[model samples]
Target: MASVALSGKVAVVTGSGGGIGRAVAIAMAEAGASVVINDVGASLHGEGASGSPANETKALIEATGGRAAINTDSVAEWDGAQKIVQCALDNFSRIDIVVNNAGILRDSIFHKMDPNDWRAVIDVHLHGTFNVSRAAAEHFRRQESGAYVHMTSGSGLAGMVGQANYSAAKLGITALSKVIALDMGRYNVRSNCIAPIAWSRMTSSIPEDSPEKKALVEKLKRMTPDKNAPLAVYLASDAARHVNAQIFGVRLHEIYLMGQSRMLRSVHRSEGWTPESIAEHAMPALQGSFMSVQSSSQLIPWDPI
Candidate 1:
């Protein structure tokens, strides 16, 4: 098979200063696509900002003889999102791909979590994806072709214990990507999501040095090693043009495609049942159905039949 290449294409990767975003940006550039690196240099909690990370990534791309530019735009605001896309347009003339990888974590059990924490995570993860993807989708519609990769999470797909806020935002991203895929299909724009598990500064806080931490880290490592950029790069390339409205879980050496949300399920109805008769009979089935329900795993596995 011939190798996939992205020559003459331009890609914008939000949160590209470090971690998966950085890796994806570098990989896309390596595959011959011009890249725009955007990051706010915020901490895991989404605080603070600096220009160093974006600049450093840009330098790395340049050193590798790849074209790139750095944009220190926060994905939280509409203007920032517009500016990030505009940077690509100003420099590269056209945008062929977008990786909406910007995110922040504000983990707290729902009752204990503050409104501010919930809003902050939602603004960054859900609204952030919307901002950037919306901007890029406009340009994509004009050009009649584009690719979008959203950074979702396992927490979002399968809720985590302490990540109520983050999980909600991440899941919302999956929903957004699906809607975009449906809306943009006519424009030849492909939209998908990735539930990635990798070790980065965001996840490094879970002590990997000790035995307890070591086990957890080891489990995570099995999902995706440090270098998990190849899949991301492929998704952002022309090779994945036909893949849309999908969610994938990318880890060390394993790729698990996900299925669609189970919005409805099989039901059995009894004949000639009054309200009381129906209540007694249907209650058990309803409860069983509800209790046995499993959330959709990742968004990447289902092939449209």
Candidate 2:
């Protein structure tokens, strides 16, 4: 089989200290793209910062004879985001691909969630994606070509208990990527989202002794290890130029494209319809429409460009 290569391209991956981000950065580098790896080196809750993770990933890439640089900027601020992208421009001269994979979790049920928790998660996930993508989009438009991959979560699509804040922010990322893809198509910029189920530091906290935990672990084990980054690497390559504004659920040896359909039905009005009469007639339709609006389905047989 022929391999997908990204020679002559410059790529940036955020939060690449470890886990999926690390895998993606290394895969891009191996594919011949000079990579800029960014990580705040914080904990799962976005607390604290260190340079160890970023430096370690960079060293590993270089050791493997790949081109890479370390960036230690938090994506929560505009200036920080700008510097992260600037690292790519300064080192590689231009950026052709970006994977907004930096994220943190502030999990809590809606009632118990504090305002600070909600705001913090939103800042890092939703606003962080905006800051980085906006800076990259400008350069992308100038170059007339670029690819973006935004990291979302299955929780955002299916919803999970005690993760109201995290889920909301992730869902916002999906929406943002879709809108960017729609608006930037004319500029030859393609933006897509990925919801991945992987075993990372973030998921290690779940106990493995329980039956539910064992089942979840088995499911995740079925997902390819960090080596299964080609799926994301492909999305960040010229090969996927035609794919835009879509979401994919990535696992080891499996790729599932997420399909969305319209939730609203067309409305027709009759002549001389009064407000009261229309309200009376619409009650049953309104109730019936609930099912369609709430309905969501997972795509079978994963495929990507």
Q: Pick the candidate with the highest TM-score.
A: 1
Could you give the C-alpha RMSD of every candidate to the true structure, in order shown? Answer: 4.3, 3.7
Residue 27, model 1: lDDT of 89
Compared with the true structure, all predictions reach lDDT values of: 0.84, 0.83
lDDT of 1 by residue, 97-117 (tens): 999998888777678999999
Q: Any runs in candidate 1 off by more than 4 Å, and if so which? A: 207-213, 221-226, 270-279, 286-305
Worst 10 residues of 2 by lDDT: 292-301
Q: Candidate 1 has what TM-score? A: 0.89
Cα lDDT of candidate 1 equals 0.84
**Candidate 2 residue-wise lDDT, 1-305, digit = tens:** 44468999998898899989999998899899999999999998888889999898999899989999888988999999999999999999999998988888877778989999999999988899999999898999988999999989877876676778878888889999989998999999999998887778766665688896687666665554374477788888877888899999866666778765465764456765678766877655566665432211132223222
